[model samples]
Target: MIDALPPLREVIETHGLSAKKSLGQNFILDLNLTSRIARIPGDLSGADVLEVGPGPGGLTRGLLAEGARRVVAIEKDPRCLPALAEIAAHYPGRLEVHEGDALEFDPRLLNGPVHIVANLPYNVGTELLVRWLTPKVWPPFWSGLTLMFQREVADRITAQPGGKAYGRLAVLAQWKAEARVALTLPPEAFTPPPKVHSAVVHLTPRPEPQFPADPKMMNRVVAMAFGQRRKMLRASMKAMTPGIEDVLVEAGIKPTERAEQVPIEGFAALSRALTARGL
Candidate 1:
């Protein structure tokens, strides 16, 4: 048995908690699954682990048991607080529970040298990922992001060039981090099971992105290009300028290629070209 906390089921039942579908909650009641996710980072000995949507403290307990120096858990659901409080009590000063929305929380202000490990709520997973990926600074506050997402979302995040699944997400995530699917879990792993299977994704921020380009510019170019993904760049980028072909030439990209076929570096070059053109 993993030490440092009570079993999650006892905590949940004691707190009168049931997973809420409205909040996109699919509680991981299985201690084994939670332990696996908590251990995905390889070693957590002295790391400050940031956990989001720690429903019933299943993952939270695992983090402590796995030897995290401290855990700062941000949870929006008030109903789950009692359960988390029990874990906090069991662990003493090692656990810090924040009662608020994670999207609005700034990790920089909390503590230094953080590592994010969470089984993110399905509804806000992608959006939260984009926010973390687009920070104004290079080498974000957290050491790395080890998160769980629906398997489909995981594929899109780690997808390579020249595929239907490859798009803005692949470009953005690949540009700044090395993301890989660490493990996959079936839908039956959870209490109130989600329809889609889940996967744990480990994303370590690179010291520098493969190509350095303005993030705002990259977002704009990718949005425009992938917005009409089926069309060639000459047709898709028509709104940017009538000389869209010239822009592609300057960026060292083939105007005939569709957005999905281009690598992340190609997109970075396009963003740079667009910036130079003042577009």
Candidate 2:
């Protein structure tokens, strides 16, 4: 056991904390598994960690036990507060729990070097990741991210060009950070197992984007191209500007290439060409 406190199963039974499907809650009761997830971000000894949807504080305890300097956990569910409070008391000034939507919580309030590690609520995982990847500032507050997502989403984040899984997510993630699937967990690992398996993705933000392009414009370009993945770039992106083929040629991209066939650098170049033409 990593802690002197009662086992997670006992805590849940005592608190009557059954997993709620509405909140995308799937509690991991095993400390060993939670601890292993915590260790994936490497040494947390000197960093403050940000966690979201910490249902019953399973990963919270793992972080503390693994020696995270401080953990700021944002939990939307009110039922988990008392259980998390128990952990805060156990750790004595190491764990902080906030009862609210993680979407509203601001990590900038916390002192850096912050590393975000969470068993993210499945409903909001992709949205949260997009927010983190596209912060207003070039380098976001968090130094790294270790997040759990459905296996398909994981594949998208780590995918390369010319694959079915590659699309806007791959472009966005790879443009901003170095991302990889660090761990995969079976469905049975949770208290109320989900239908699909989950994987943990680790991302380290780059000092700058892989290539320079207006952020908003790049996103718009990517969105338009992938909005019809089967269509060639010329057909799919014609709505982007009057001279789409000229723009594609200037970017060194073939107009006949589909969105899935265009690499991140290719998209970046397209974004730049559009910007140059004042699109």
Candidate 3:
């Protein structure tokens, strides 16, 4: 067991802190859980880590305690800085807490090899993952993402075809990264416990997507197709294509296929066709 960091409950009480709903805070004080998450992305030693919404720094402490070479924590809510600062002091420079919004901050701008680990603020978790997956450049800025999301969202992120959860998120995430469910934490594990149970998902970016497609067009195609997921591709993509059957033919997808039935490559092909037609 790691022993460097103090008990997270003590840290929270000392800061007179409670999770703030406005900030989408759900502080996980369970060292066991946090440590388990910290370990999900493999060896942390000598790796730079980007942590977001580190309210009360439980996961931050776990990352550092488990020997991450450096941690840059971006906490959106200013109220949590003092609590995080205490952990920074405890670790003596291994931790760097940035009091700002992680969404606006570009992880690519950070110095070196980075892995992202966060018990993410629920409101922005899916958006954040999309941003990372479809960054302006391919082969994203982070080495891996070990993040906590509502169990349902986690299911969608790592879901397979033929499942209700499979749709745009599964296509996008799996197209660019290898994703899997790492662990699940009950509601009671957090300070101001969230109504939903949380699951940790680990995603490693793939060197190449299953198929080549323009990122912007890919996003648009997925958005449009899944925008009316129940409809067949021929109907759903009709707005952009009077000849979606032909487009599907050109891409080797079937006109009758639904968005959930098509895998990542199918979306990539559609994305490429739309880009080719300048849709």
lDDT of each: 0.89, 0.94, 0.86
Which candidate has the highest TM-score of all?
Answer: 2
Candidate 3 residue spans exceeding 4 A from truth: none
Q: TM-scores across all candidates?
A: 0.96, 0.99, 0.94
Over the stretch 56-104, how does candidate 2's per-residue lDDT look in tens digits? 8889999999999999999888888899999999999899888899888
TM-score of 3: 0.94
Clashing pairs in 3: none
Model 3 accuracy (lDDT, Cα): 0.86
Give the winner by lDDT. Answer: 2
lDDT by residue for model 1 (1-279), tens: 576466767777788778888888888888877888888887888689999999998898889988998999999999988878878888889999999999999786557678999999999999999999988888888888999999999999999999988999999899999999999999999878889899999999999887979889899899999999999989998898888899898889999999998898888988898898887
- lDDT for model 1, please: 0.89
In the order shown, what is each candidate's alpha-carbon RMSD?
A: 1.3, 0.7, 1.7
